[model samples]
Target: MAHDTGSSLTRIFAPAKPPAGAKAGTVGEAADAKPPVVVSLSASAPAAPAPAGAPAAKSFAEVTTDARAALDANLARMKESGRTLGMGANQGSQADIDAAFQGMDRRSLHAIASNSGGLFSKDEQAFAQTVMSQQLVEATGMDDPAGFQRDPARGFLAGVRFLDTVSAEEKASDNWRLNRAVAQTNYESSMTRDHPGEKAENVDSGDPVVNFLAQTIRSKEGTWTSVHDGSYVDDLSRITLFKDGTDASGLQKARQGAGTATRDAAARIDITL
Candidate 1:
């Protein structure tokens, strides 16, 4: 008789099939007869977003791919314009070009995208009022040290600084008391400590002093009187108001009459006797 394959020996030559509820194969039998496994894996990892204010980081391969595409478009346009062009019809290896762009830096990319593409002609110093550094240079017409030269972004920043400086100067010089009621009282009390000297100098500047002095006179902080038949004025008024004048008995009495207060200067009188 012919020898049977394992399947024929086990299944066909053996007893009839077992009931569906019964166990089929032993654990070891199933383990040894396991099928080959087929695993499927994706080609690349998922992307991660960069955080705010952070520049996005990219691999050399990714960057090179973008740079090559952009340079290709540029070459095409130059050829169409018939101004002369180069670069092969085939796309560049993104790896090499991306390496170059990454090495160049952010500003270089900006320059290439901007100036090479004839961008910013309308956006910058295209007019007189432009705050471009070149415009500032033209307006100020300064020369020599290149620092005085204009650039759009820097000129704008400098002009803002200039305006801030001017505003500070005006605040110092004008002394425009923004809170006048509070400032006025503080100033008045300080100035009237003395008058007609350095203390007065602190208060009266043109109209302020004149107005202050007039105010002092009305407030009687400044006073005028007749003493020893002399006219005496005191802001730090006179030290003494009355002095003994000789009467018939030769007794001295303070009179409502003029006293010796005027000893520092001339005396005044009106005689009705």
Candidate 2:
């Protein structure tokens, strides 16, 4: 995102302001003292609707057979990957299952996606995101209240703002360089050839997700006029695009390519905020 030199929102860093207090790592300590309560998490798409006119199986035998077949397929997939069934990551392990609902009412957590205690709850569902979101952070196998307050996204956004607020002297250090690699990859790109009648053109999205894509072309350009010309506030327009529901479709729209409007100055202040 190498852009021309006159950018306000897009920059090497943001203006500095001393924190109201020291960098408080005390969130963890204070969280430990609070009894874990059931919370609802709505960070992603909502539950899928049940199939229309699809009747339940006639008996327990059918249910058993279906479950067994599903497990067999999962096992086969594991075998192909050479991964142990109980291995780490988001693999649906019994241990992972146990920790996902940790510190909350067991029965309540069990009714996830179907009830108020589902993933949207502040209880078990939210806790699961922390343990499973990172590779280095192991599944504690203990569902406790302390991990709940350490909201990963908040921590990340806090760090982002903090980095923006730091002096250039602090930003150029070794610590910040490594942190750059940790930024999530959410960009998408590709080459395409069309029929004779179709126009050929390049598609570059200034969308936030596209900017942070995991699989990307990895261009060297920084936030610039030709790269992502729009202001940083363009992200709010993406958010505004999906104000109705948090369904899969909504998520897709909310994360659509922002490149088309990346240079449109009018879009910056267009959202509800």
Best by TM-score: 2
Please provide, for model 2 over 1-273, each residue's C-alpha lDDT reduced to its tens digit, 9 standing for 90 to 100: 322222311221111111122111122222333223222221222223459897752343333344334434545665676643332232343333333334332223222211221224332222222222211111110122234223333333333333333223223222222222122211111111112344323222233443332222143333222222221121322322223333335334534433344435446656634
TM-score of each: 0.17, 0.19
- TM match of model 1 to true structure: 0.17
Model 1 alpha-carbon drift over 4 Å, by segment: 1-56, 85-145, 148-273
Q: Write the per-residue lDDT of candidate 1 for residues 1-273, one digit (tens) a residue.
A: 111112211221111222122212211122333211111111121123457889756543444444445545654554576632212221222222222233332222323322323432221101101111111122211211243223222322332222222211121111111111112322343334322243322322222322332343334322222111111111112212223222212112211111243332233332322
RMSD per candidate (Å) reads 44.4, 20.0
Q: How accurate is candidate 1 locally (lDDT)?
A: 0.25
Candidate 1 clash total? 14
> Candidate 2: misplaced stretches above 4 Å?
1-120, 136-208, 212-254, 258-273
Query: What does the lDDT read for residue 200 in candidate 2?
Result: 27
List per-prediction Cα lDDT, in the order shown.
0.25, 0.28
**What's the lDDT for residue 238 in model 2?**
38
